[model samples]
Target: MQAYRIDGVVRQGKTNQDFCIDLVAENEDQVREKVYSNFGSRHGAKRRYITINSITTIDPSESSAPVVVSHFRDK
Candidate 1:
């Protein structure tokens, strides 16, 4: 399985008024889908949260390392 990094101002069991979105997705369409899915759906059908932040796309520097980093951040 592959992992993707998502960065957003997640509201714990609530909605963020001044929300923002920023993160890396599998593709262009996945970007909107991911955000909507995560924000709209409840976590484990219990906790609800909204990602009000930006997500950054991260790629592995090397294959051996499992570390993922991106220059995705608020300016």
Candidate 2:
């Protein structure tokens, strides 16, 4: 697993940082297992304001570098 530093601006230009997680497993099942075992809480009780910072891969065939995937605000 790897951690990414997600920097963004909130309302009123307040800076915030979020920890974006990325990992590669042997298969889809392993990915699910890891995410569930570790990030199930964050996934289950969705609070919004979640965002992705980057998604770099160890493989060299990627066309572009990792970028933001999504962003939201908690109500």
- Highest TM-score scorer: 1
lDDT of 1: 0.45
In candidate 2, list every pair of residues with a backbone clash: none
TM-score to true structure, per model: 0.35, 0.29
lDDT of 1 by residue, 1-75 (tens): 122445555554455444444444557457757666756674432224443345444444322322223332221
Predict model 2's lDDT versus the native: 0.36
Question: Which regions of candidate 2 deviate over 4 angstroms?
Answer: 1-20, 40-75
Worst 10 residues of 1 by lDDT: 66-75
Best by lDDT: 1
lDDT of each: 0.45, 0.36
Mark the regions of model 1 whose C-alpha exceeds 4 Å error after superposition. Answer: 1-4, 13-25, 44-49, 60-75
